[model samples]
Target: MPNNKIGGHYSQAYDEELQQAVDRLVDMGGLVLQQLRDSMAAFTTADVVLAKQVKKGDRQVNSFEVDIDEHCLDILARRQPAATDLRLVLSVLKSINDVERIGDQAKRIAKTLLKDEQGSRPSAEQLAELNGMSAKVQLMLQHALLAFQQIDADKALNVLREDKAIDDDYSRIMQQSLSAMMHDSQQISVSLQISNVAKALERVGDHSRNICQHAIFLSKGRNVAHLNDDELQQIVEKKRD
Candidate 1:
């Protein structure tokens, strides 16, 4: 009975079921995004309490993934969705896996903070660079979730393009951390921890990009995961025209 693009099923119950699954997926995305933010804050500020909270939150994120996966499987078995509905189900299934992995990456960062015994922190300049990189990837994750909620291919494409900047930031941070280790042997432990955090953040960016690719697939009904930026742009633009 709902008047929407995804509606029109002969059974109104089927329409509601699909919408509920989407709503749950969006809720899961919000929780994962918050986990990432909390983990970054804990790492940067050395807040043990927040870091512990992030670790505890990972369990909840995992639960959501399992629940959603079951719901999607139920839909597939019962509804046998076709066309756009099939794409929606498949995209949700793929995106939730990426979302769960993002949560794991956040947990990895939290563990790095908890395991660090060295009192030394990154230099102010390096911390600033890390903060900048964190903000970029956080924005990317947020936008990717929004794109999925709306099924907006253009927004998803933009999120996909931003991954390169995160990659560059990761490379620069690795170089700086290595240089610090070389200059002061005593700083090696802390530098290694910083490198690990950077690696986790880099992986978060990758998972966020994967979610965006799933969003594009949902909207366009085509897998853009392997397409380069230029190729993806052409496809999205062609859809617009």
Candidate 2:
């Protein structure tokens, strides 16, 4: 994703700076992925300690967003990057915001899990559904970040396709949880918590899609923001044509 041609001025310092920015972005992505994993594990195990740690780790994710944005701004001001280089920086800036929000969503899941220690927890079947949803979301983010790193538009589109499955899973989880709550009045609080977690997982998929959208923008320079599935597929088809 590093563009070497910026008005033909290929300073070593500029190249290093740009590369470092991308490295930070990758690091940030990895950190959020870990946060998601830890948060889900904490919830499933009902480990208050791990949940607390996940909540505390959100600060590091926030820091990475701030640092990366500053570096991008510095490059824009000093290097005045153009063409692909400019696109790279802009995409990184936008994608990092999504990554940070993913971390926040993970943190929210952890907080919800830890909200009530004395109350009943989710049933095993519910946890399995939640874990499945989390796995899909985690994979989506993983692919999105890889696509971002490689500036691979096809990979980004594939991530978009995966989002639909996750959405379906989220809807199924919500339905199951709601049905369980209706059967047992005591299950209301725990069911609500699971619903919130499912919603957070769905939002994570959304943020991952946003990252992939930025990747597409970086690769094709065709601002595919806010487009639906069919529309995005049409754009890809047009590019292929």
Candidate 3:
């Protein structure tokens, strides 16, 4: 049955405005993604100017949060959309906080790197690995946001699966940093910064997982996180069988 109970809804003329709002939210997500990537770049290159740019970007992303919140509230107050329509508004309202905090984590990473006295880069191999992990998490975030907007469960599931790979990558980074720390007393400070950055990347991976989880919940009413990959694969196999 089609929902026909819309109250005080804007006419068809407002469809474009509503879509623009969603686009702006996605744009906000994009900005955060770039910040995360650039933060890592700043840390890896010991570029204080890059870190400063990231800090500046933090303020801008916060403004996006505020603007999106106001627009969502306006939609709610005026349209009073119910059911899935209401759900979309509320889920976005909730998800933006996670996105904003992800930006904050990037800011923290930038600040930490800016404090480095030696201005050294992380080892080439280690930096490459970290870059790979960062790319994965960033892509997952982008896919999750797109999935939310498009109600694409398959894309959401892919984002969920990608988290494990990010975790595995971070684990290796941790082990390597820990080994480096244990071997050289003089390297203690650098090792500490490296370990913390790895942990922050791991945290961002967790947030990506959370975003995908909510995407599944909002779009399909599925709680995908409760199942392990093997268990989930089995569930899918059985359904196909």
Candidate 4:
């Protein structure tokens, strides 16, 4: 719905500016998601080269973010997209920061691989589990971006559910890696690297989940991300009343 080629500026109309801003953000989200996925691949395969590539790509994501940020402000200034439109555009602005941070986490993973001067890899078992965690985080990112573009609150909530699972997996992998380190001094350094990567991935999950929360809020006018199921139910009931 966004077009860069639409030579004319936004008139006193809403439709033109709104679609352009949304389009730029969707492009930005797609790029950020790819960075997260590639960074995860870097950890899973111990592909330092791929990790570097993902790291380099973060700059583009950042650039896209700045461009979109400017566009949102311009739209707000020029069109004053009101009510739901204003909320959606503002959420896009806020969520892009999370997306950029997700790229940052991926870059952190790449840095871990590079800093491990010894070039050690995680144990095969740990690698397997880390890969699984990566897969889920990827899904969360994918869903978060999809929900944003689709404006689907249900899909956004699904991304929130995936966040809990990611944290659980991260904790499980950290425990396993730590146990290995305790048993042998030689593994201490590499295990720490692996743990750090896992933590980065987990944070990526957190950011993606936060984006979903923003999407839900934008679409349905609710802040369900911080609330438990019970609190959410009460809020829903109060709204009905």
Candidate 5:
């Protein structure tokens, strides 16, 4: 396992910079989490005002990505970090991109809600699978961010495991939406909108899993993104001799 502590550099300033990068990243994660939560709430309640707010919040998330990228680049230029330190910077760089994309997915969900015509709300039965998927992806996102904050490979692996469930849920929702569309041609428009929201939630799960993969890379110094579940379990469980 990699070092959990981040501030043992001989250069005190270098240590501070690394810590600052982590702090900012955690802050960004928190914002994105709330963005997703609010977007889902807006969807469930058909709250146009909240959906509008979630859409507007995407700008701040984009700004966070740009700021974090600049900070990581500064570290790479000045510190030229190697080994674990290099992994830390590189993981932060990769993680921020996923976090920003998660934010974008949230914005897409919000946009789907906002675009619905008046009196075109989807019934709760139609939204059931979507609601389930929203909850799971939110939990996955929360755990993935926590894994990065704590540098816990086990937690990252758990997030990876949950990703397959999200994929399954997405497939189920698509099938249900298609069935609804086929049964009632008039339901096609509403079914299509629900499909869009489900797709956004699925993408959110994917982005969250990507963040977890970066966490694993940071902790293990191994890229586990393309690994099968069994292979990932083995890599994360193996101890250095």
Candidate 6:
């Protein structure tokens, strides 16, 4: 249903404007990636100062989202993009929002980590699990942004595949955390904070997957949003061949 191309262009200036919108979107995505990196580091290292910095950086991320949205609207209203160009514009519009949400998740992780008192900190084992989960989600975000930059469906599908693993990690972390809480009621607050951070990481993974889906839509002209892993794999393989 969606075509991927800049068709029926009125002028070179209009085409450049559309491309600029995409460039700006990519820039915003980069800011989100940085925020995730900083927030994860703060969570693992117990750096409240770095956490505070992440919270402050959220405002810039929010601004990027607004600016990109406005740019997309301007192109749609004035330039009236069609075909592949229209698909690209629509994908960028959706992805900006997704990136913004990822930024919010980073902020949430930072806030939760900052609230944790010294003696109430999660055990090293729990922190290790959180670190591993954070690393995986950060990788996902990196690759998702790369998929958008290259418009590579294969890369996007790879991100889609990663979502399941992150989900499993979240489940395992929660289960272990709950077990720890049961053994020591005094650790309940720490366990809850760990659980919250893990949940935030899971949400970042979900947003990364959404960005990958948008990349697939932009590149393949197919709506793979609702497709399961098996279905997505089939589509991806067919495209590769």
Question: Evaluated with lDDT, which candidate comes out highest?
Answer: 2
Residue 22 shift from truth in candidate 1, angstroms:
1.6
> How many clashes in each candidate?
0, 0, 0, 0, 0, 4
Model 3: per-residue lDDT, tens digit, 87-159? 6677677778888888988998898887774655567787787778888888888888877666655677777
Candidate 5's error at 68, in angstroms?
0.5
Q: How well does candidate 5 match the true structure in TM-score terms?
A: 0.95
lDDT per model, in order? Answer: 0.87, 0.89, 0.76, 0.77, 0.88, 0.86
Model 3 regions more than 4 Å off? 1-10, 117-121, 222-241
Better of 3 and 6 by lDDT: 6
List the candidates' TM-scores in order.
0.94, 0.94, 0.85, 0.87, 0.95, 0.91
What's the ranking of the predictions by lDDT, best on top? 2, 5, 1, 6, 4, 3
Report the candidate with higher TM-score, 3 versus 6.
Answer: 6
Per-residue lDDT of model 5, residues 114-201, tens digit only: 8874647789887777888888999998899889988899999988889988999999889988998999998888888889998998
Candidate 1 segments exceeding 4 Å error = 1-3
Report residue 53 deviation for candidate 4 (angstroms).
1.7
Report per-prediction Cα RMSD to one decimal.
2.1, 2.2, 4.6, 3.8, 2.1, 3.4
Summarize candidate 6's per-residue lDDT along 94-150 as a digit string, tens digits: 999999999999999999887774647777888889989988998998889888877
- Per-residue lDDT of 32 in model 6: 87
Model 4: per-residue Cα lDDT over 1-241, one tens digit each: 4433232434634566666666777788788777777776777777888988987888898898999899889878876767677787888898889988988888898788777735667777777887888889888888888787777666776677778889899888889778988998888887898889889889988888788778777766766767874564454345423
Least well predicted 10-residue stretch by lDDT in candidate 2: 1-10
Instruction: State model 1's lDDT.
Output: 0.87
Compare the candidates by TM-score and give the number of the best one.
5
Model 4: residues with Cα > 4 Å off, grouped in runs: 1-13, 233-241
Superior candidate under TM-score, 3 versus 4: 4
> Between candidates 2 and 3, which one is better according to TM-score?
2
lDDT of 5 at 206: 85
Candidate 3 lDDT (Cα, 0 to 1): 0.76
Model 1, residue 30: C-alpha shift (Å): 0.8
- Regions of model 6 farther than 4 Å from truth: 1-10, 238-241
